[model samples]
Target: MGIVRLIDRQGNRHELQALEGWRVMEILRDWGMFVPPRCGGSGQCGMCHVKVAEDWSGKVLPPGELEAKVLPLLPGRGETSRLSCQILWSETLDGLTVALP
Candidate 1:
């Protein structure tokens, strides 16, 4: 298992241990965090967009398909943007910190 930290726009932090290979968005919806699953966890919706401050987790970024479509529609879209449904958690991501926009 790996630890993932999610911070809201207000600077609130939420930390959880995620299973390896599960995408970041999967954890959010599975744990029923505040994430609004407008498309039922589908990669099409940009509602689950979050900011990855540092992703040393070695989590392979999902293919350009989902991100290419979702990132631009969201509020915070810098270098680190993985459609919550697209990111898979890895052991290296134990201390990963992300800010939800």
Candidate 2:
């Protein structure tokens, strides 16, 4: 398991216990963190957008093809922008922090 931190657009912070192999979006939505997951973790809807914390940006895996295609269209897309549904929880992601966009 891992501890994932989510910061909302309003600057509110929420911490959740994330299980291995679970998607970040799943954890956030299950914990009522405000992620819509409109596409049910299918990577189609961009409502699960989150920005990796600058300090931990390199810890998470890079975006795959679908994410690459969808992310750019969202406002404030940047090096840290990522779809929460596409992020898999693992030991490497322990203590990961992200901000809702």
Tens digit per residue, CA lDDT, model 2, 1-39: 779998988998888999999999999988988747779
Q: Model 2: which residue pairs collide?
A: none
State which candidate has the highest lDDT: 2
Candidate 2 accuracy as TM-score:
0.93
How far residue 99's Cα lies from its native spot in candidate 2, in Å, is 0.3
| Candidate 1 ranges with C-alpha deviation above 4 Å | 55-59
Per-residue C-alpha lDDT of model 1 across residues 53-92, encoded as one tens digit per residue:
7544245554577668777777767777667776767886
Candidate 2: where is the Cα deviation over 4 Å?
A: none
